[model samples]
Target chain A: MKLFSLEYGLFLLSVFYIFYLLPHRHQWKLLLAASLGFYMITVPLYVVVPFTICMVSYVAGLLIENTGRNEWKKAIFIMSLMVNIGILIFFKYVDFLTKSFFMALGALQSHFFQGSAFIAAPSPFNILVPLGISYITFQGIGYTIEIYRGNHRAEKNMGLFFTYLMFFPKIYSGPIERAHHFLPQLHERKTLDYELVSDGLKLIVWGLFKKLIIAERLSKVIDIVFQNPDHYAGIPLIFASVIFLVQLYADFSGYTDIAIGSANVLGFKLTANFNFPLIARSTTELWRRWHISLSTWFFEYVYNPIAIAKREWNQWAVIYASLVTFLILGLWHGASWKFVVFGLLQGVVLSAEFLTKKFRKIISSKLPEVVNNCIGVMFTVLFFSFSLLFFKAGNFSDAAMMARHYFIFTGDESRIYSLFQAFKLSGVLKLTFLAGLLLAVEYLDRNFDLKKVISRQAVVLRWLIYYMVIFAILTFGKFQQEQFIYFKF
Target chain B: MTDADVLKQVNEIFIDVLDNESIVLKRETVAKDVEEWDSLTHIQLIVTVEKHFKIKFTAAEILKFRDVGHFCDEIIRKLGAS
Candidate 1:
């Protein structure tokens, strides 16, 4: 079920109450049952593959841990890595690979016959891609590697380890929990506190407001503009791109908030994935903040190993490593060539920054630091907006068309004027009116503990604010679109 | 050699590799404690240490060092083994 849907909301509410009623030691069992139930309900037979992966990795972790021979341990590690990564590739990339193979064959076949004589179209294979397969598989691989590295001990309990992999809150789109961080916490028998419940509820409310009001509404217009950018020009393209950047932020971060909030109520703490990424002053810094868990996964698993292997190459090593890491990061988002190009662009930009830090430092020293930061923020936002055009577009050609329209401004004066006329400051204001309210609360909540601040206010004032927000949500909310934006990934 | 001697040599290598001469590493110091020491510059630091100390670490050993003290411990162990 979509996390924001009414059905899932009822599920979470009932699950939360049922969880605390259980004896402390049995709490984990309740969670495991809930997790399995959630998976079964949402994905049906798709659950078997992940269950198999979890079992394989669990056995692999134990073997690596128990084996006294170092050679065997390393062999076991590589075998486990291959199996998990192999599963990921087979499931996630099969359709892409199949289509690509058919296209290539079609090209070769078309050469023998005249242009319209031959066509090869492969039927799209419908694979039941399990929920959070990438996330759980990565977690499993990391666990195996950690065991071999002597960093973490293998979990003796199969059930607990399985629960960690199948944990339902993060199953759709994860702040991919590392084994070392999440495993020990699972053992703690939690007694629910009133404060924890309140905080969790507040965060969930805020997350819902972000998704239902801002992101869904913005997506309607974004879908129209991106779907047919050739029909529009200049300002509309720019406007759509900018709005899209914010919409993605609102959607992804809102989902993350809800995930973290739900886990918190359940007395588990998933890592924070987004930390005000839009406010980041530099692209490098933005990457560090955005999808932090995934970024760390790449840095630790992909970049560091490659860098160390090429250590003698000096900074060239850094560039090579970063290029590979970001490309994989992009590919992880989807199986399209668009994602490949998007990643290549990021790797190029980031490598450029690394190579020219000395020159950039010299350039920056001439400006005031605050002014430099402002410029950096502006540049990053524009660059990010440009890159996401590929992510948002139907394909590479659409992205190119949008980019062309954005820069060429070749439409007739009447068309241009009408496009400009279509831009309504008031329309955006109306759509984002509740959005603005949410963001203002978020801003206040940033520097200080907003809940604590609200706690100290008169009870009537606090209730008034709460009631007003809830009222607005029920009255003005777009409950129609319930799927979180990241579920596809 | 004791960890103290390794620490002295490693401290100089950190200063050179990180390009920050003011760095004074304590036993508990990790990557986050230093501003210039990030994952990108990490291998540079490791390679510099191996060159200066004339020792090598395996790929697994390379990623397992937890802090400066843990790094020094590995260096000492390697020196003794050699």
Candidate 2:
């Protein structure tokens, strides 16, 4: 279910009230039952797949824990990993792989047979992907991997492991909770604190404003340009590309805010996934701030192992690790060549940064810190925005055309005139006003901690502001259901 | 070997790998204290230390060394054990 939907709102209200009345010990059972109900609500048949995965992983964890210092535990861990990964690959990538293989074979055959074409019908056995399969699957594997590494002891209780896996707030799109950090907090007594609740409510409101008001509004403008870039020229495409970045950031991060806030309201603190990535001064810094949980996961599980394995290669090992890790990470988004290209772009940039770190440091040290930071921020955002060409494009040709035309100096000489031509005064002005307002809020929040200041404000003033915000949401919010961009991943 | 002797050797390795003769090491030094000592250099430093000391570290042990002091302690303990 969509977090912003009326159904979810009503469901949460009922759950919150019921949760409020429950004693601490029984809360896990309620959550597990509610999680089952939530999955059943999304897709009834697919519940079997995720439930089976959780139960299998739970058994694997138990088997690993009991067979200490035995070879069977290693075999069991490998078996569990294979089952989880095999399911993901079969469901997500099999078709992509099959099509790709045929396309390659067709290309080779074309050279031998003059009139031959590579054409094959797609497979008929269509499988419906479960909503939170990747997330839960990763958590399940991470649990067993931790057990194998001796970093974590397996959870003895079956229900608790299921509760940990199916924590519904983070189920669909995740902060990808670790078993060690998250499992301990599940059993703690959670009496509602009014301050925490208010903070949670504020975060939810802010997240909604970003999604409904900013991202949705921006999506309309971006769709016009991206859907048919042939109709548009340089500045319009450029504007759309920049706006798409904002829209995506707002969309994904907005979802995260609501997830974290909802968890916070229930006295469960999920880890943050984003941290003002747009303002980051370098690609490395940007990655550290953007989708932090996923990046950390790859760093821990993928990159570190590869680098450690190839430690003798010095800098080459790091380069190899960065490329492989990011390539896999990109493929994780979806089964598409475009996503591969997107991942490659990031990998190449990171690899280059590793090679040129000292040189860049010397150059950066020459400039004043503030000036250096500004230039760094500009380059980082521009580089990222440019690479997203593959991510937003229809196919390689359109993306190539966009990139080919990105440097065109002839089309619409004045950038200002082009923007005016592309957007209506009201549309442009409204976007500018809202964007400026958002920047103000972000600035205050980042620099001075806006939440703390808000807490200190007079009660009447606070209520007035709250009412005004509610009125604004009613007046200007987008009412249509727009799925979050990360849901497919 | 003494802490000072290991520190001197580490300083030499840092200088050799980073190609900067002016580099020095301190007990308090962390990754951020040296611009050249990123993740790539980090593993190289560890592997070099392992080769130099003729000892191996588990992944967890390698991860436990938060700074030069922690690293020195691990190296000393391993040397004493050997």
Candidate 3:
């Protein structure tokens, strides 16, 4: 069930009710059943994919922990990695691989044999990848890696291990909880805390506001422009590109908020996935703040080993590792060449930033502090927005067209007016205002815990603020229920 | 070498690799406490420490070190073992 739906709300309510009714020790049993039930209901037959991962990872963790011989442990680790990664690659990329193979063969035939009879491309099987397979695979692998590294002990309890992997709240899109962070919590005796639950409810409301009010409203316009880049250019295209970036952030972060909030209500703390990434002054800094869980995952597992192994190459090791890690990260996003280009663009920019650190520092020092900060924010935002075109486009050619058209500023002010007309004036104005308000609050929240500040306010004011938020959401929020953008990854 | 000696050496390596002479490391110091000691510079410091001590660390050992003190203790333990 979609997390935002009435059914999911009822389901969570039922689970939460039974969850606390059960004894603390038996709570895991309820969670395990709920997780499995949730997954089964969400993807029916494809539940086997995550079930298989949990089994493999569970057995591998025990095997790695029990094995004394380093070589045996290493062998088991490699095999487990291969199995998890293999499953991910097969389901995610087989179609892309098949299409590319046939295209290459067709090109070779036309060059050598004059296309004696042009080979027709076969129809795709259109395999349905399991929901949250990427998150599942990464979660399983992260757990196994921790065990293999001797950083954490393997849980002997199969039920708890399964529950850890299949936890319903985060099973869809994860902050990718680490074994060490999440496992111990299962054993704790959780007493219902009214304050924590209230906080969680507020967070859920805030998440709903972002998704429905801002993201969905903007998505209507962004989708139109992105779907037909050739239909319009200049200002409309530029406007969509800039706001599509924002829409993506709102949608994905909104989902993350709900995931984390639900977990909090259940007395489980999932890792925070975002910090206000919009204000980041550099692409490198942006990554450190954005999609923090995944970025940390890559840094910990992928970048560290590669960089350390090639440390004899000095700074070249860092550069090489950054490129390879981001490339893999790009491929991890989807089975498209456009994603590869998007990822490489990030890699190239990061590498250049690293190489020019001294020069940039000198230049920035020459400017006023406020001016320097403004310039840095603008550059990072534009760079990110440009790269996102590649990520958003249907294919490489579409992305290239959008990029080419971006620079053609038709000097037509009507283009903006037409966009406003298409979006409807009130909708566009609401989106603009909400987007700004979200950024301003995020900036302030970073310096001070705004939630805590609100909690300390008079009961009347607090409730009034909450009511206003709920009122705004109900009145202005889109009910179309767009799926979260990161769900595909 | 004693743990204190190893800590001293590690501090120097951090200063050199990060190119920040003002970096002062304590037993409780973590990566975030030092401005330049990020994941990228972290590897540089680790490699520098290995080269300076003529010792190597396994991936597991590197990953397991919780803080500067844990790191120094591991280095001293390795030195004593050798």
Q: Which stretches of model 3 miss by more than 4 angstroms?
A: A109-122, A232-235, A410-428, B1-9, B77-82
Per candidate, chain B TM-score? 0.95, 0.93, 0.95
Model 3, span A415-477: residue lDDT tens: 777677667788678668767887887777789888899999999999999999989988888
lDDT of 1 at A343: 83
The top-ranked prediction according to TM-score is: 3
Tens-place lDDT per residue, model 2, A64-164, is: 98996669988999999999998888888887888788778777788788747656646735567788788888888888888887778889888989989
How would you encode candidate 2's per-residue C-alpha lDDT over B1-82 as one tens digit per residue? 8999888887888887776787888999998888667665787788878888888888768755778888888888889999
Each prediction's TM-score versus the true structure:
0.92, 0.92, 0.94
TM-score of model number 2: 0.92
For candidate 2, the C-alpha RMSD (Å) to the true structure equals 2.9
- In order, the Cα lDDT scores of the candidates are 0.83, 0.81, 0.86
- Clash total of candidate 1: 0
Q: Residue B47 deviation, candidate 1, in Å?
A: 2.7
Looking at model 2, residue B55 earns an lDDT score of: 82
Q: How much is the lDDT of residue A281 in candidate 2?
A: 84
